[model samples]
Target chain A: MNINFTLNKKSVTIDVDPMKRLLDILREDFRLLGTKESCGEGECGACTVLLDGKPVTSCLVNAVHIDGKEVMTSEGIAKEPIGKLLIDCFDETNAVQCGFCFPGFLVTSYHYVKTDGEKNLNKIKKALSGNICRCTGYQKIFESVMLACERKPLMNANER
Target chain B: MLDINCQYKSVEVSGKKEINMKFYKPKSLLELFETSEKIEGKKYFLAGGTDINVQIKNGMIKDEPIIFLNHLTELKNILQSDNHIIIGALTSFSEILESELLKNKLPFFQNSLKNFASPLIQTTATIGGNIANGSPTADIVPLLLILDAKLKLFSKSKLREVPISEFYLGYKKFILKRNEIIGAVLIPENAETGYETFYKKIGSRKALYIAKLAIAGLKKISNNKIEEIKLAVGSLNEYPRRLFKVEEYLKNKLVNEIDFADVEHFLQKEITPITDLRSDKEYRYRVCINLIRTFLNQ
Candidate 1:
């Protein structure tokens, strides 16, 4: 089946099984390896991606569901202003350890900071609970997201 | 093990057999029924695809026709009537959290939604799927039961309403027909009226832990007397069930007049807890009594 969807900012079509996991299609078919798959199940948000502007586990999402929807993986997030600011903050806070789970954290944190941006530490922790990090004990990750939200100006929906 | 004998069919797409299984995304209810009538082989209704995807990958499910309900606008509505609210079957937990209609009315449902799998899974896990999946540990089922929710099951020929309490037949079993799909959940508008409710899930940790033993209760005290009480517990038996005996014992009694020690012994007979991966039978039996005592004291 031919699946037509927007990746990053470009519209593209690919011939693949509709039941194929979006994580596999992105990493293998599109060669966009930014999205990682750790548990394969939805437990770990290592394969997190923005589906129609909401963060979801791509490992559980079917490619058929993305027929006309827009998918923003970690690869395309850096181009956005919020994504760049988050990356910079992560670097300054030493948030990225082994970097295996960095992309998922980046994508999930990007959506969290963009939409909620609650300065409360507990709220931020709850928002990012889906994504797991083994290297950083989450204090630095929370600090990184907090720093990014404080340093960057509040973005409009159009900016996201 | 799945018998993949006649289930595998090679579909020619773009001059090649690119797809292994057929996938249907229905745009409307009429289209969904039409497609349902035409399909000859096994069919699985895909909602959220959270549980179905894992089952398909793990070889626990066989190769079957999938009917995707994500595009049907009729099944995605959260409508409110004067006396009741109808939540569509495809409504996700994320949507449930954000719904003003549900937030103002049914906060216990929202409380259960918070303890559901995770934010990632909640974004895609639908209430319909949670009920249809028939897992004994489904966090939302017990709450729905306590809310006195009813499910609207739709077939190509007719539609029928079944109370959520009577929907489950046994372990991982529901009374739904093969051709039927859940349309919407009908919850009474005054289900929470004058009732103080509590929902608790004792899990290993907060985020992704499946409930060792979960409890949902709705209690109303009038003049220091227990006027009405409804209790449902899950993950302690073959299926989640309402505690009729306990509910009856507590009703119409003064809150402080009842002894909790005898009540715990009576409640133990209501459940058949078994040793499982999540917890031991003895622990489940003990925590349930403690939870009930705590809930009543609250």
Candidate 2:
């Protein structure tokens, strides 16, 4: 089947099998290797992607659902404010340790900072609850997410 | 051991003609029903696949064609009426958790979902799939039973509504026909009158932990008398169960007369739980009885 969607803000098309995971589509077909897959069953959010601006586990999600949708993969998020803030904050806090969890953490933290940027410590913890970081014990990662919220001036203006 | 099947098919998304996906996508519910109907055996339905994805990754589902129900538009509405609210079959747990309608109709139905699955799982898991899966510990089952919910099952040509109590036949079983789809769930709107309610789930972990024992209660305390009491307990039986003998005993009893000890006696005979990885039979039997006393004190 032929699948078309906006990836990294560019419209593109790919032909792949029906059962193919989005992780495979990004890596094998699109040649975007930044998105990794571990525990491909969706338990590990290593395959996280922004489906229409919301972070989701890409591995468990079938490519069929991406029709015409704007998916901001970790590769695509560099231009967005939420994504940029996370990147800056991660480096500041030494948040990425071995970095196997980088893509998932980046996507998860992007959405968290975008949605709940009040710097409410509890909200940050709750929002990133799904993004598991076995390496850093999460203190620095949590600090990075909080720092990202602080850096986003636009997110605060729109905060409810 | 369960046979595993993994032959996947491509489906087309309706209305979005310009873009397409490689994965199997049925353009319509009719096609989904027809395709699933023809499969001889062991074909499974994949809605959100939050619970089943783990099973699939472990090769629990081998090469059988999985019927993905994500594109079914008919299962995505929350229609309301004077008598009841009809939540479409595909209505997601995430939607339900954040819905104003669910909060109004049955508050706990939405609140309990906070612990239904992980936030990621809730984003994809559907309410219909949860009930249809027939897991005794399904977070919504006890709440649905307490709400006196009913299901509208749809087949190729007919639709019928069945009360939630009669819906589950046993463990991992329901009275649904092969062709029937659980189209909607019907729940009463004004049933909260004079009713004091509580929902409790004891879990090993806060998020994504399936409850070892979950229970819900609704009591209609009228003028110091227990006009009615409904008890729905999960993870303690083959399927989530309604404790009639206990409910019947509590009804019409004075509020204080129905003390903690009395409630304990009734609960002891109510649940017949089995041992599983999450819990032991003896522990369930002992803890469940004590939970009643705790609930009453609360």
- In model 2, what lDDT does residue B67 have? 68
Worst 10 residues of 2 chain B by lDDT: B13-22
lDDT of 2 by residue, B1-298 (tens): 1112333432222211122211235567777666666767666777766666656455555555566676677789887877898899888877887888878776756776677656666677788888888888888888889888999998877889999999988888889988677889998876554577878888876555788988888876667777777888899888998888788877788766766566657766766677899998788767776776566555
Error of 2 at B162 (Å): 0.7
What is the TM-score of candidate 1?
Answer: 0.92
Worst 10 residues of 2 chain A by lDDT: A151-160
**TM-scores for the candidates:** 0.92, 0.87
Interface RMSD of each: 4.0, 4.3
Fnat, 2 decimals, each candidate: 0.61, 0.33
Give per-residue lDDT, candidate 2, residue B70. 69
DockQ of each: 0.55, 0.40
Q: In angstroms, what RMSD does candidate 1 have relative to the true structure?
A: 4.5
Q: Candidate 2: list runs displaced more than 4 Å.
A: A154-160, B1-25, B222-225, B255-270
